[model samples]
Target: MPEAIQFVPYVLVVLLTGIPTWKLLVRVGLSPAWAILCLIPAGFIIVLWLIAYRRWPLLEE
Candidate 1:
């Protein structure tokens, strides 16, 4: 039971970061589910580059 309490903050952090990330990705025309990638160090940076370059698939003209 005590161990479970320790996981609460971790879960909250993921939700706090992930939810907004998902929305940001969706607004940029990328898949919203990619939000889970923000939880990873490399993926987080990759997402930043994706946005910085405006390289989402939907951006192709």
Candidate 2:
């Protein structure tokens, strides 16, 4: 496989994960900048844990 082709899947995966992370953080009243953590090592795990267990301060009535 071409070296350049190998990067395509990686880029796609980032996009796939980033968009949802951004939206989820926003929905829960967190800063969208938190989504960038998804691109860092072990950050995705932290984000998932936060999303699963943290209480959202902006819950709609």
Candidate 3:
């Protein structure tokens, strides 16, 4: 039980950031699953690069 309590804050952070990031990724024409990268070290930088280099679906349409 004590061990499980330790994870609560981590889980909350993931949920808080991941949910909004997932939505934004979808809106930007990237896969929502990419939001998981935000939880990783320097992963947000990767996602930013992906958005910067890739063509947006909205723009293509």
Question: What TM-score, computed on C-alpha atoms, does each candidate reach?
Answer: 0.70, 0.78, 0.72
Candidate 2 ranges with C-alpha deviation above 4 Å = 57-60
Q: What's model 1's lDDT at 15? A: 83
Q: Could you give the candidate ranking by lDDT, starting with the highest?
A: 2, 3, 1
Evaluated against the true structure, the overall lDDT of model 2 is 0.84
TM-score of 1: 0.70
lDDT-wise, the better of 1 and 3 is 3
Tens digits of lDDT, candidate 1, 10-40: 7887787788888888878877777777777
lDDT of 2 at 20: 97
**Candidate 1: 10-residue stretch with minimal lDDT:** 52-61
Per-residue lDDT of model 3, residues 1-61, tens digit only: 9999999998888788778878878888888889889898588778778777888788898
Considering TM-score, where higher is better, how would the candidates rank from best to worst? Answer: 2, 3, 1
Number of the top-ranking candidate, with TM-score as the measure = 2
Better of 2 and 3 by lDDT: 2
lDDT of each: 0.78, 0.84, 0.83
| Model with the higher TM-score, candidate 2 or 3 | 2
In the range 1-61, model 2's lDDT, one tens digit per residue, is 6999988987887898889999999888778888888887588888888887867867545
